[model samples]
Target: MPPVPTDATTSTLANSPAASLATSQGSRLAQRLQDLGPLLGLILLCIAGWVLNPDFATAANVLNVLTRTAFIGIIAVGMTFVIIAGGIDLSVGSMAALIAGAMILLMNAIGTAIESAYLVVTLGIVFALLLGALFGLAHGLLITKGRIEPFIVTLGTLGIFRAYLTYFANGGAITLDNAVSDVYSPVYYGSLLGLPIPIWVFLLTALIGGLVLNRTRYGRYVQAIGSNEQVARYAAVEVDRIKMLTYVVLGICVGIATVLYVPRLGSASPTTGLLWELEAIASVIVGGTALKGGEGRISGTVIGAILLSVISNILNLTSIISVYLNAAVQGIVIIIVAFLQRSRR
Candidate 1:
């Protein structure tokens, strides 16, 4: 009618609007399923727990597990950032112990001079945060500027940090000042409405972490670096700066965790955070983050953290499973998840 449509025009019309919409819908559906995988796995795990023990569904038990999960969950948030940026931190466990021991020592050293328990605690908090950030910065510099492998650098630092803790405590526990402990105990054991305070801390950490990774330009750089460092460098992204900052973020997360942890036990020993680095790394991987880097989801990480905690809780609740086998169980789960991911690829 309109001067006779050409063959190309007909073909364009055939593929326009409706076809495009259908394709877009299909893509979104695929993405939705991908995002739903971890959550679905978590639900299945919870169901299995209920089947294994009726008490697994109890509110008290559930809350207890969530509260305990907060510690590893917080650290894993930082681990997510580091891993997504194509790096790893093998020293978090030792770093946590170092921070805790150093903080307790600092507080006790000043406890006699400062009558204000609040002031002493505040100073301890500041010191812990600063130390964590500084240590992170140092690690970043060595990795970025000094051109060292993250694994090697963090491993060296891990031993150094744990040794410092041992020396600080003199092979014993560094207990917090009793007066300060009395004032700070509520921070960990206290409740906000019906939920534990630790849960609130975990929620806050996760929220900020998600925003940073999803909504910030820095996050884009992180993903870019991990995906292909050469491509990112060609695009004028500051690869070194972004990678270093990721470690800083990790350190701050560790600091926040130490703050919450100190209030619970009111002490720090060489073994305070022993073997925690593995748990944090495992949590990140279980959340569907690629071990090779370049992609991750924060919400999935929180779910993964919860899933691990639930398994540990279940194992504890069941006498049939030896408590010593907890680590073995975790290793098996990690292996299974890795195999599934490989198969999916």
Candidate 2:
């Protein structure tokens, strides 16, 4: 047998610069793997989809998956900011429903007075965006000024929003006028360069969101707040304002999505945006954003949204599992990702 090493030798080796460098390198490699995990999983999922159903690879089907992903994908981009700043907004779905209903009502009511369908649609779009911003502002104020938890504030607004929409619709659907809808349908159905408008819009939103998150001082402030609010305050980061603005961004995203969605179905009802919160949050988490906040990527969120949409599309195309189980799959995915995040921590 070889001679046993003494404590001095072992301790010297452990304390050496080479050992420290190796440890640091190992940590970086592990972090790199974690960052790429979601993208790799997305690619594997796509391959599995194609293997299960050749149609999954078709251009038409691909566009359809992306088009469907636009709404939640846009919302998930906003959610990336909120989550990175350590905030949550459960009211987005209900808020969308209210905005949709109000927009349709505004367009229809204005159409009766204004002869220009184009003008009516423009006003409605503006109304949707403004309402979204205002709603987001309210959430921010409530959380920051009123000193309430983000979860509790959003949960309360979620119920209030949906209830008001239901009351406005009288427990029925709020259908857009045919004339206004005809002019508006292109927002959802129209294509440019053979790609759906919604998809293009989704890409633009993701691009802007990525820039804001990674490039700006505001982005750094948001991350700092999420990492440690008290520390960030001590650093003069204006934690409350940044946190509030995050909600406003999320609200604006919801509004943009609603504007696109109205033309597709031409109606909003109690069930208009059911379970959207689940999908948005799931997309953010699935994209590799930490549930505890302070860490996330916009690119990861886009990939996560597409990945979830692909899973749903595959389920719809294949009989291996019922499409009804799609939500179940998403829930399970969130749980698995959350567990993985915890393990990493």
Best candidate, lDDT-wise? Answer: 2
Predicted structure 2: lDDT: 0.85
Candidate 2 regions with alpha-carbon error over 4 angstroms:
1-24, 322-343
lDDT of 2 by residue, 1-345 (tens): 223433233223224332233246456576667677778777877898999999999999999999999999998999899998889999999999999999999999999999999999999999999999999999999999999999999999999999999999999999999988899999999999999999999999999998887677677667667766776777776888999999999999999999999999999999988989888998898888876776688998998889888877877888887677877975675555444433155
Q: In model 1, which regions exceed 4 Å deviation?
A: 1-31, 322-325, 337-344
Cα deviation of 181, candidate 2, in Å = 0.6
- Model 1 CA lDDT for position 55: 98
Question: Judged by lDDT against the true structure, how good is candidate 1?
Answer: 0.84
How high is the lDDT of residue 20 in model 2? 39
Q: What count of clashes does model 1 give?
A: 0
Each candidate structure's TM-score, on Cα atoms with residue i matched to residue i, is: 0.89, 0.90
Error of 2 at 336 (Å): 5.2
